[model samples]
Target: MINTKKIWYLLAAMAVILITTVALMSNKKEVEKTPKNPYQAIDGAKTNSYEPVGESLELTTDDNVIGNKKAELIVFVYEDYSSPYSAVLAETLSRINSELDNKLTIAIRPFVTAGNNISREGALTLMCAQDEGKFSEMRNVILAAAKEGSLQEGGFNVYANQLGIDETAFNNCLTNEEKSLKLEAIMAEADKNLVIGAPTIFIANEMIIGARPYSDFVDSNGDAVEGLKAVVDRQLSAVGTKK
Candidate 1:
């Protein structure tokens, strides 16, 4: 009787131990198999991404004459000379402006997107033009020359001559330390704006990355007068609501 009792007690203890072990194993499996959020996974995947340089400079259309002063729509494009997409979009933007007839204003900010060398030189050239008060003309000439792949054909001197810019003054502007610092500032602004790619355009606050289709630049779908009326009404409403 004593031996049988001892045997029964041993079996009960063994069963309890076995049950506890199984429960622990099951709990571990459950924890390991639990799913994670898909959005979180995606965010983790994109953690290494970065923006371009020279994105911070506040772009303005005040210098440009194409767009309305109070126009709700403002388009900002970040471009680099080495980028083919930037070249194509530049041409397209020009056409859009002509077709729209001052309805849209495009503000351009130069950034080096492709690589360090081309972007640096391109930014410097733009700054030099700005210094000489020939920014618009020089910008057009460079874009045209870049499209034709003839920027280096005449070097800086020949290109300056073609644009009717004084070669000596232009060369001095390019080599000036002050002008170079300004260009660097522009690049730093671009970096701050988180511009990751070339031809990144912002229509109002809406960000459009890359060379978008021409249809993206079309006028509002609503009646033009209706849109204008809405804006006017909102402004008047705000005025009336002010304390």
Candidate 2:
């Protein structure tokens, strides 16, 4: 009664503060409820988070293999020649093989996602190189070219000549019906395994779908683990235990 106007003013101010607080709380809840991107990778980082595919890739004698066949672990990689990610993976796997003391067998199969002659030609060229014992060399040349954006569909013969792959034999192999059949069979096998993209890797019956660095293979927390190396370690440990 003595100061009714002042009391009303104070009440109105308190109401405004309460409304603001409630709105802020509601917004915070909304933010907390939002989902995160599962495949979100760190910017500029070479490592990637992996999803587990609970299936094994059967290795065959016809598969283009690198590293020692007697290795305890076999890793199958399905890659596209025209994909930069596959190039990254080739480097990563090479490093991993070195770090692991050549304890891995890396089998490579081509999955032509680029849908062009360059990719198909590259794949066929690799098969030809394999016959000539120059698979690794030709693969390196192709990877380098792909990385540099200089890979040409019609330029495979130049690479063959540079690598001393017997130009005639390489050209004949490239145009061979048998090579085409083998590639088709490989593509069908990849499709059966649900390979959706390039650089898909299979280790210890788990599928990793992109190029990942060795560091990303393990988790920092020591409990939550996801990466190429992490899965490989687990498989190695299990194999050791079984032995």
Candidate 3:
């Protein structure tokens, strides 16, 4: 005896299950297609929270630096000039180096992001400024321009005279293809390290992304400045403890 009603009920249930499975997989694909973050400048001095990504990343150095080349600790900064957080981190590291008697060796790895002309040009300007031995000063100049939202107006020239670099020379370097190509290589390096944002700091293979309070890095009120002072102190202490 063929049970017609039972067979029809079983077919309907299987169809429903199949439809639900397909719907679920389609939604999963959509979610995977979306980005977890929006590409935009971080608010001035405010940073997103990040967990330590472990000590597996490798970094490189640049001639543009702030502390002892042979310092026990080397901090590699993968930064985009137009990022407000990157500028703040720069100032924070400078303060840390000064406090530590310039014991921290800082390396700058330029990360030029797509669709950010200001950052691209700002980096180029800083490289040109580095040629005349005023890398830090001109970096501040470019950072100031970024803060004022005037990087696109060729505002790096605002500090050209201060460094004794001719306006024409600065402009030429700012638009130089050779320097532009060099920055491209550096950006590739950032990609090699899996860096996806500005102001990512690498210390002893450990990395912290975005901006963090200076206090978080060392001791005192976490309300002061933005950077990774704690990483340097902690690593130095660990080395001491090992000794």
The number of the candidate with the highest TM-score is 3
Task: Mark the 10 consecutive residues where model 1 has the least summed lDDT.
Answer: 38-47
Q: State in Å the error of residue 241, model 2.
A: 2.4
Clashes of 1: 11
Comparing 2 with 3 on TM-score, the higher-scoring candidate is 3
Candidate 1 structure, TM-score to reference: 0.59
1-243 in candidate 3: lDDT tens per residue?
A: 879999999999999999999999999999999877533323332334233433354434454666898787778887788887887888788888899898887888777778877777777878888888888888777776666666664666767887799998888888888888888887776776668888887765456677655774432545433346666677667666876
Give lDDT for model 3.
0.72
Could you tell me the TM-score of candidate 2? 0.72
> Scored by CA lDDT, what does every candidate get?
0.59, 0.79, 0.72
User: Please, what are the lDDT tens digits per residue for candidate 2 over residues 1-243?
Assistant: 569999999999999999999999999999999977444333222344344433457778778788888888889998789878899889988887888888899999988874678888888888888899888888999998898889876899999999887888888898899989999998888877667788888775456787866664344645333556766777788789888
TM-score of 3: 0.73
Local accuracy of candidate 1 as per-residue lDDT tens digits, 67-182: 55454455667777656677777777666656556555567777775445655666667777676677778677777767777655226556568777787887787678986776
Greater TM-score among 1 and 2 belongs to: 2
All candidates: TM-score: 0.59, 0.72, 0.73
Could you give the C-alpha RMSD of every candidate to the true structure, in order shown? 11.6, 8.6, 6.9
